[model samples]
Target: MATFQIEGGHQLKGEITPQGAKNEALQILCAVLLTDEEVHISNVPDIRDVNKLIEILGNLGVKIQKLGKGNYSFKSDELNLEYLESQQFKDEGSSLRGSIMIVGPLLGRFGKGYIPRPGGDKIGRRRLDTHFGGFIKLGADFRYNKEERFYGVEAPKGLKGADMLLEEASVTGTANIIMAAVLAKGKTTIYNAACEPYIQQLCKMMVAMGANINGIGSNLLHIEGVDKLSGCDHSVLPDMIEIGSWIGLAAMTKSELTIKNVSWNDLGIIPETFRKLGITVEKRKDDIYIPAHTNGYEVASFIDGSIMNISDAPWPGFTPDLLSIMLVVATQARGSVLIHQKMFESRLFFVDKLIDMGAKIILCDPHRATVIGHDFQSQLKATTMTSPDIRAGISLLIAALSAKGTSTIHNIEQIDRGYENIDTRLRAIGAKITRFD
Candidate 1:
């Protein structure tokens, strides 16, 4: 296990560039399986989860070549399909939740795909029903091994498209279905689909690869089947989650930081959501400039004078991934706000650690929390903690940076799974964080 020992109450300066989107990288990496041609991808984040997926690809016989930093070429010309049924694959595949996506492209091209029960952050119940449900709608037979905890989907005659109204606008689910639909026999219509930038990027990449996809940024997606898809070069957008994290870090520590080339238009509701907590999110060309919060920020109330309620919904709404960061940022703000983590029940549990640090938070339930900002009247006392998930891990890191003394955060692997070289990057910006393996 790796740990981070952070010296708190330090101001960070200089600019930080957000890495390529982790979520998008997961989807795009899987899309490589849809074609046998070489797909060159640049701006890939060097993170644990993405690297694990790339490793899984190599194990499955995808030809992978490193082009440069955050650049790689993948060709799935001679996949070892038999590996999908191996014990080695089962152990490797189960380690990443993103591995579920491989089933779609595999079933699309090779008539079969199987995956062991995938693993990821134990934030809450993350079901695989949506992914499998879409496959079943696309004329694939689904089977579940109760004893082995494995899933299998096969389409002997190839897939045939059908209209599907997704139960929820699950991002990965939508991506999985689109990959399969692109190779189906006819047009497929998906309503109530996830329209997050990651999904839109996946759609755009598929289009560039000769797949017919419409509705790039809407809930309704139409994909026309193609006999074969040729590979094309694609670059991932900067990770919005990381950008949001930097914004929160700047505010909590009263640091003036510039986040460069953030792909402003794709950020959707992120900047504005941060601004709701009274943080200054300035637009400088394509970058976001967050000035130090010398005067603590105040939470904005509703027009009718009710408390501000920030919640996550489908895209174009506040992202659930940043709610942890928001909650921590609110700890020192001038007023109170309610954080509603609607999608996952257990994500807010990390607030207990903040409470130990003297932040005034009321964990109303598994899904909600009310934070009464100290307005910097009281500084959080440093304490030992453990990271629970990727987002929460970064959130705790930000809190530790702004706390009164040194703090220890164990299980930093959770943070590394999403953020690349986080300690080194934070150090460059003047953050005093040390890593111990």
Candidate 2:
């Protein structure tokens, strides 16, 4: 396992650019399977989860070539369909949660898709019912092997589109269904779909590839099935989650940092949410300039003097991925705020580590936490900790950077799964972080 040794209380200064969106990369990469022609992709993040999915595609006989840094070309003309049933595939596919997306494109193009139970962060119960349910509604036959924990979907007659009202606006679920519907036989209407930037990017890419799709930035989507799709070049937007993390890091460490080319328009509620916590998020052209919080930040209260409550919802709302970073940043703020993590039940459990670091936090339940800011009056005492998930791992790293002394964090592989070259990036901005394998 890899670990990070961090020396705290250092002010970071410099410009850092956020990598390509990880969530979008996962979905967009899978869409390449829908066409037999070459698709060129730029700004792909070199992270663990994305790399694993790329490797899975290669193992399935997709001709992949590296063009340059953060650029690749994929052609799925002659895929090895038999490889999908091999034991090696089961082992490889089960290691990545994003691998579930490949099933939709495979089932749409090849009429059959099988996947072992996918694995990812142990945050909470991440059900696969939405993905399979959308497939079943589109006329695919679903089968599961309980003993082996495997899932398969097949449509020998090819998929036929149908209207679907999703139980929840699940992002990955919506992406999976959209991929399948692009090649279906009729028009497919999806209501209550996830319209996050990642989903919109996927929709836009599919449209560029000759799939008729409308409603790019709304909860309702309409896709018209086509005979086939042609590949096109696409570029992923900068990761909003990483931008939010950097904003929080700048506030907590009292650092003046400039996050370059952040795709400011795509960041729906992220900047305003941080501003509500009294952190200055200035928009300079396409960049975000976060000045050092020399006097510390203050949590904003409601108009009626009620405590500020921040929660996650569907698109255009606060993202659940950044709630961990928000919670960590609040530890040094001037007032109190309530963080409600509605999507995942167990994500807030990592607050115990912060409590040990001398932060005043109340874990109200599995889904909520109340933080009383220290106002920088008393610095967090450094302590050793273990990363729980990707978000929580980065949250801990931020906390360590703002703490009083040195801190050691184990299980940094969880951190590397999302952020691209995180330690090296931090080092570039004058952070004191060391890696140990």
Candidate 2 positional error at 104, Å: 0.9
Question: What residue pairs clash in candidate 1, if any at all?
Answer: none
**TM-score, candidate number 2:** 0.99
User: What is the Cα-based lDDT of residue 370 in candidate 1?
Assistant: 96
Per-residue CA lDDT of model 1 for 1-437, tens digit only, reads 99999999999999999999999999999999999999999999999999999999999999999999999999999999999999999999999999999999999988889999999998899988889999999999999998989999999999999999999999999999999999999999999999999999999999999999998899999999999999899999999999999999999999999999999999988988999999999999999999989988989999999999999999999889999999999999999999999999989999999999999999999999999999999999999999999999999999999999999999999999999999999999999999999
The number of clashing residue pairs in model 1 is: 0
Candidate 2 lDDT over 79-112, as tens digits, reads 9999888999999989999999999899999888
* lDDT for each candidate structure: 0.96, 0.95
Point out where model 1 deviates above 4 Å: none
Show where candidate 2 strays beyond 4 Å. Answer: none
* TM-score against truth, every candidate: 0.99, 0.99
**Which residue pairs in candidate 2 collide?**
none
